[model samples]
Target: MADVWAKISAVLPGSVDQFPLQFSDTVESSVVEILKRCRQQLYSDSTGTNQTLYPQIVVDFSWEKLNTGTWRHIDKEWRRVYSYGCLFKAAALCHNSPSAEELLQAVRTCDMGLLMGAAILDDILQVIVRILQGEVRKSTKEDADESERTEVKRIKIQCPHAPAIKEELSVPRIKCPSLESFNTNYLLPLKPVILEGIIDHWPALSQRPWSIEYLRSVAGCRTVPVEVGSRYTDEEWSQTLLTFSEFIDRHILNKEDGVKGVGYLAQHQLFDQIPELKEDIRLPDYCCLGEGEEDDITVNAWFGPLGTVSPLHQDPQQNFLAQVVGSKYVRLYSPEDTDKLYPHQSQLLHNTSQVEVENPDTERFPEFSKAPYLECVLRPGEVLFIPVQHWHYIRSLELSFSVSFWWS
Candidate 1:
């Protein structure tokens, strides 16, 4: 065992490479012969399923057997080493250069017990030396909400109890509006309007969590960044990188927790992150009318649960907010209301209003009541055009996912 350990410790790293667990080395004959010998020695159970600790041992980490290898709500053993490693790898991938020492140094302290526990570890990682690196993309527990799975049509949220007249502030809704027509009326005027039929052709419209089963299969292993806060206004509000699967399991599936905050996949360039999902959407033809290059147009994703809010804020570029799944309540104030909306005193928040649009404090933010704004409950397959510098507040009314295209 000592000799084997010594031999195992001596090989090159990333010959195994990173997630989806790279194995370009396996194609080489010498590597093949070596792995063939490993198979012979580690035989009798290509699956390490035979080595069960009696009573199917559990751990304080809340690691329990859900089926075979999965446990519910356990912290993914993220350590300082992984932070360094991930930073290194992401930088390397960006620059088109990968370093082996950089990868090995990252996992230098990771214990093998975690690796040995993963059932698929031995079967795949047995070039003789198996190092278990867990980048668990989490489970998208689709079974949790049957209501989200059902197809619903034409659900729009109304802003509750406002004295504001609807006519001056009402947003227009149009069907199949062309680039020329949209440019003539809405785009040129910088007016917010909802366009239907733009997103009906998207492949993501038919995907999991929407088509939860297929999403579970393809996106289960993919890592994503998610926002976890009761609301951004809360002191405890923060962001974390998580698996698409775990995001579904905890935030989406385990929704019995009272609505204080939600797991929001907000403002992530998910189409660029999850290319498999990029096929599910297309950029609006009207975006081509922008000053930026078509490829330079920024496409962002917003996936969240009920009551998730963006507060009252503005972005620097023109926005096409496209709804893919569920509904969102959106309110917009033109840049003309900049002073009336009370821009935050801080430079970072200068573009955001101090007033909560849903429940404004007339005494504290007295001027907010006078800010003229357009309001709409954005429904599925609707795209809301938000011109740059427009102060917008967004709240997801259900488990929702949306795409926004931003261009100069």
Candidate 2:
């Protein structure tokens, strides 16, 4: 498999490989020639077709080296490029009919000129590379010669904090209920509410014993191990047993491969079998919104005994995490406590010290000593919501399956 993929990869030039030649001053001339050829092919003066109209150009490239020496035959691979099919259709629709003002209006209203420009650039670069080098190689010594000579400067970005809450000198203070109430009131007021027992209601677990087995089989579990976490290889993760019953009896029961040997589960199948889980899943919707929307949403699920103790980091969206089976411990800090967390030097808001939260290296993250936090134990069937820009770390307690939904 590795050899086959290596051969295939060697034959294709990825986008990054074509980047250096793309920005050359020669690109403009290449685009003009390609566009002119396209206009001629689609609308010729002899045919009485309008020459003023711009026809969309689809450009492609390939190469072959002639050998004079050997009688032996060797097949050489060639690279091919197709204009994004959509671009060609769009170009046909906008053909020479629209005035320059009308075209400018269309380009602005549709906002696709930039995308068209980028595609044209990509196609132009491929052709230029082929014209310059008769044969395509993964990379060439010429690439080093053409490398940008300018020094790159790093720019620092700053995140602005919300305005401070004004102190009310005249208003009377209300009393708290107990020590726990006072602790909640004075420290970490916006802590997450941890709920347990949601998994008990999951239909697959209750109605079918085979469902449990199937899940265990998919998870590659024999006797559930005592230790908390594990990671699996890709091949171990792809095996499919259709019904939950076949999964448990056939896959789970036969565990010659140790539990830890199991890799990631089939993500799509996991969602397909548990359709109800999709309702709560939040995918990033970036098209209509502005910048940062895409990076704000990320979902990750884990099956099998495993725990990830990530260093504290603040995200823009709130998190709704559900533990399907097993238990985990969580510790959280609020946005206001940024000063106490000992953040990084960059513009990133939360400078979560790289030191593990469970056991900190006080010498390096001395400011963490000033940070106050709330801790909770989340059990199977429960959900916990970590608020926007809050910091947290998780540790799995036993064999577990969990899903996390994050959104603004």
Candidate 3:
């Protein structure tokens, strides 16, 4: 064992460490070869079943070198790594287990355990490596042209029109005989008009304790930058905050730099924290689900108030924005008003203007001069539906708490 360890150490970099409990190099190599043979067999006879195992093990051998951070490392180069961890256990079970069913069950259990362990280890290693790399990079960089750098800071635009009248629109007082009648008569008929108390009947609203606790837990959770298809850890979950003040103090208020991007406030995976939301929110559903794919659900928590106005962008899904607490001003344009809005060709639903509504960049977004939209205030318990492809700019009126549900 000592001789084998010495040989591996001599061949590989000092950084290339493996756990002691893991398979030895010789056994690992043998397992990998067996997996490759199984894969080739699977490829030749796709339907063939092995009696010794629950299912036939499939393997494919592909050549890829593992990196050890040094180009001069000849011994580490051209190392053959097999991709069939699952197949290795299956083949092992087929060789040693008494019954075919038992062998198959053992293989399945072993493969699953190995996969989960590998995933957890991979996450830890990635984070550690990233941190180390960042530290090294930070220590090495001092560019001569750093002082020459400049960025085009976005400007805010103010609305030329005065604030629209805030009328207390009467909530529809129709009583339905049944859920069917409510859907057909009231919900269907009022598709054009925004409904005030749609959430009043939702069972989730009544389960306020669960909802509030969940929100607080999310807010208190440690926020990392958004990454694609990454799961939040328990450590991250513990940092989720319940109150707006907590979110701002921990994340937003202390940062001396100005905020950028509407999605920047809440760390990524906020949507994943919501157990009930299986799919993203969309627009057509807001317009009575006329047709189309569902909206991409986007849930972000803003720590500070959103200062600049957002551009007019239309989405395919219906929107159900649940403002937990906090205030926002939403300006909406109708789909029929597309000609005046001057939408960009790259995206059918987005306007050409990137100008903030509070400070329109006339030089770049000249067409925005003609764009007119209706304004509404979205408070807690109220959701504003902009409809599919409707142009809108949403600005935080105060330190706000909101969750938006979109579906087509």
Per-prediction tally of clashes = 9, 13, 31
Output the number of the TM-score-best candidate. Answer: 1
Clashes of 3: 31
TM-score of candidate 1 versus the correct structure, residues matched by position? 0.62
Tens-digit lDDT track for model 3 on 5-52?
132223222331331113335335654455445434322323334532
Model 2 TM-score is 0.39
After best superposition, candidate 1 residue 381: deviation in angstroms?
0.5
Question: 142-189, model 2: which lDDT tens digit per residue?
Answer: 221221111100101112222222333111122222435423542235
Ranking by lDDT: 1, 2, 3
Name the best candidate (by lDDT).
Answer: 1
lDDT of 2 at 312: 72
Q: lDDT of all predictions, in order shown?
A: 0.58, 0.40, 0.39
